[model samples]
Target: MGNITKRGSRELEGDGAPSLVEGPRTELHTELYAAIMREDCTAIQVLLSSHPINQPVTILANSTSHRFLSTQTQSIMPIHLAAKYCKAQSLLCLLEHGADPEIRDSRGLTTLHLMLLHWPISSTMWTKLGNRTQRTLTNTQKDAVRCLLILCEHGAHVNARVDDSNKYSPLHLAVAHGTSPVLSILAQKGAQVNATNESSMTPLHMAAELLNQEMTEMLIACGANVNCAVSCTGSTALKLAVCTASSKAGRLLAAGVSCIHSLLTHGATVNAQDHEGQTAIHEACFGGREAIINLLLEYEANVNILTRNGESPIYMYLQHSSNLRDRVLLTKLLYCSYPLRLTNNQGALPAGIMLPEFHLLRETLIKLSQKLLSLEDICKRVISNIYGEKHKHHLKQLLPVKMWNSIYCHDSAYLLK
Candidate 1:
């Protein structure tokens, strides 16, 4: 074995059982990792200079063998390590030294993928950095972006799918993680905006799920499929927006409306239903958004359309809402000016079903029934006035006496009395 040196200063362990300098090599890699994490480039250079490039130190896992033996034994390359630690300058240094961007650990994630996967950290840290410090990218983000750019420039497959999990691509990761900077870089590098994972979800679906309005708009601008349904459940980005129970539903709804306009302009069907036979109207109703429901109706959504379970928008609202004021408002909006006797597939009229907390709705139905009866009485009176007493007698036999008395009684209000 060759003689070992510390900081290239003194030769040690000539006739050695184990070289005394071996301890320094182990300590050097650890120091390098620490320096990278702290963004201390100078300390990293000093550490790197102390060791020969071919001297094979177990920098990552501290194993004596340089070659990985087991799947768990595989150590991340320095660039992979830098990306994992969010050390941009260290990543750049490794990339500069020709570290493999395509290196995969036990998880098979590329350095870029790892950076994208660790996105929440980037978002939280960068947001704080952006707010507290300069408006420019933080030290951490600058390093991350630089690493990502290097990978992209080196043909790192901007649209590479993550290992065997087709649920995410690099674009999906970017959008899902809220890594806007990384997303921009990938988009500019020709990543497919409408690419579906195993779930058949485009990047837009991820942005909608995260309720990231800015990311949704960015993906839309890049031509993501607004109405593309995920194969897992056949949910579109708009449908997913309303499905979430989060308070961001309002913002998501607004985004969905914008996406709907774009989709409709591009020939998307407003009444398109999912695998469960639930339309965007069904989603809006379940979400209890009167504004969203109105928007869908204005787009000519089939308001009375039923799901596979035989529930219409009104039924969905009744099932999902416990508030009386909301039920009353929704009932009036859905049933006003429409005939209730229109039978659905199950032979039940839309207005006949008793909704919970909607006593006002039941009262409204009774009122409508009375109005129909009054119209019949007026038709009979008109016949008596124009045709003759004989025709009036014939009409009187056809009409129910109770209905007639209720309409024409002028004194005592006999039914009430």
Candidate 2:
């Protein structure tokens, strides 16, 4: 009922007020944009089917008060407006009236890509932080989920990559946002499970790096490649899980074990090296997670695998040998066939890298590195390597479920020959 104002299409009146041009078609374009944003579905139906303006017409991005865009989008269409504001019924009306589902904004984001950027991160955080407000968001989440399904069902491309520097796919956004429901919808729509960003990292790699066990397993079940190398770094999902837990203090202690087990069972190449040639075991030792180290060994991880600098996992462990809160892990790595003559490219042996302040501690580790494993240690290592390498996925099938933890993933390292 009031005078509509669109940027480019508007002209200044004599009193210095900006107002819409007095043309029939331009007026119709202005009305259509407003109707879609307010979700006036009936009004939108009448405007589109009867107006002289084109159904796929767009307005300037600044026309709205809330801008969800990162960079400037030259122009955004009715579908973009409806999606950004979450006007589901209005969006469906426009789509039914022949709106282009795949039309992209100047930033090259389709309707689906644009909507996910504004996803309910607060809702996900509440659930993670154990707040009671998540129940209140249930109906709202259902609406958002339905919006995504409607977009996908109307032919929005699930694998369409953003034309920005990040080059994120819908799957990448879903994982980064940590919403499994939205991720599941995209996957069901045939989103590429292994789609890479500009960094060459897959959704599975992101899941692993985030240390989300449920997401990691979901991607694996959806056929994510567990062994896929990351962007330029050549780090796989197994290494990512351990590396992220490296130094977050005790908050992240053993947090990656569940994700590591999922990756291993789904076929993670345990000994696969990064660009620097460090294996998951090398990282696990550096992080000082005995549980993760033991889990890797259960999968026949080669502790002696060298880095590009020729450093072994034992050398990495001694970096904190004196500060070790528990000696059981250091002892386990020693018994797991750590090479006695270990040396990096610099010709420094594993025991030589210990902190200088702990001279007595360094000498003790140097002596221990050269000693033979006790019979109990030897038998444990041999049986663990054999069972894990041969029957990785059937841990419960071959042993008592109770002993599974003690033998393969715990400090006990118990095993049978």
Candidate 3:
């Protein structure tokens, strides 16, 4: 319960100085501010003992100290400033003096939020530089996770929402910022793995969006919802994996396809459509992912299922030349046991619109059409055989007899002869 003391406008008062209406304007406070700025722990300790203030001094951007701290500006506290400036000693001092770790700035960010935001650079350095550099920093300084642990010890809420964005908890921020160490701490502290933001996107979604396959797998291992749909686009993490097309996408796709396998095994609907009426097949098709398409088909994806716009996965493939192989693959998959025909709702077949480059495909469709016509002629012959000459004559009357006679006979009288 130390009290801050002020002397005259120019000098500091003694420890037992009379209470003034306002706090200290002493050179001691100024020196403390400078000490905090320069990370001079020794000077800060001496100044704190002399003025004996229970509350830590707040520093503005210009490096001036305010005796009375205000949370009105941006909800920033002294510890937040210290964390932002990477002054570990000053941060510890403020924490020791009963600094509110959860005090949010105008942005609704607590000291913990600030710490997490600034923590990644340290972790990234460790990740890139190896254990020797990590030991060097750990021996001489606190790393990001250590800082997070300090904040947690000071009662910073591990799951507090960051500002009004409501997009990230400390865990989300840690993962988003690539602070692997901080992410582990947050996860261990019971941050929700499936926690979502305004976009209904879990941390896994964020990780997938960034193509952080490692983080994505970690989140999934921690029970992140693999099929959680983003609010904006209703895209699941698997869909995102197919869509990103980055190296991260490759990793996520590997993991996500496995998840998809499990989900399908456990009875998650493969044909489940999103808001746009697009299923996983649609996503694979739109993304032009030949491998993913094959995977989905292996799992019995309904190839002919139409999207909201009446476009089947094959239609989607045909729209983009980038997806030609996928289109052809889907077409083959759809027509493997059946004839190759692109029929609309009215049963009208897509004939002239055959894939221009697929010569074999065009020939197959033509042969199938001719085979169907021949089958109809055979059915007519069987009926004629059953009903005799009178029925045959009636059937011949219905036929395009003139054209048929010209093709089969040298003259109309030749058939009679």
Best by TM-score: 2
Which predicted model would earn the best lDDT?
2
Tens digits of per-residue lDDT, candidate 1, 306-366, equal: 6786666665654443423454455443332222222335855444335545556556644
Q: For candidate 3, what is the total of clashing residue pairs?
A: 6
Candidates ranked, most accurate by TM-score first: 2, 1, 3
| lDDT of candidate 2 over 1-417, digit per residue (tens) | 333444344433433443434446545665676777677888887886666322344333234432332222233577877787677887788778777778887778888887887765446656464445676566567667777888988988999988889899999988887776777778878999999999899999999998888899998888788899986999998898888866554555555677778888889998999999999988888777677777787788887688899888877876665425455665566556534434578977555345565566556656755677766656656666666545745865777776565556655333110
What digit string (tens of lDDT, one per residue) describes model 3 on residues 1-417?
223343331132233333233344334545565676576767766776765434444322222244432222221345666776567677777778766787777677778878767663443455777788777666533545556667777777878888675658877887778765566667777788778877677887777666566676667667677777887777776556555642225666676555455444444456666777777776676666666666666555666577565656655554454444434454443432122234445554343335477656545544653454345444443343243332445546666986434322222221111
Between candidates 2 and 3, the TM-score winner: 2
- TM-score of each model, paired residue for residue: 0.65, 0.76, 0.61
1 versus 2: better TM-score goes to: 2
- Model 3 stretches with alpha carbons more than 4 Å out: 1-30, 33-76, 85-89, 122-142, 231-233, 246-272, 295-302, 325-417
Backbone clashes counted, model 1: 1
Model 2 alpha-carbon drift over 4 Å, by segment? 4-34, 49-75, 121-136, 250-255, 320-326, 349-354, 369-417
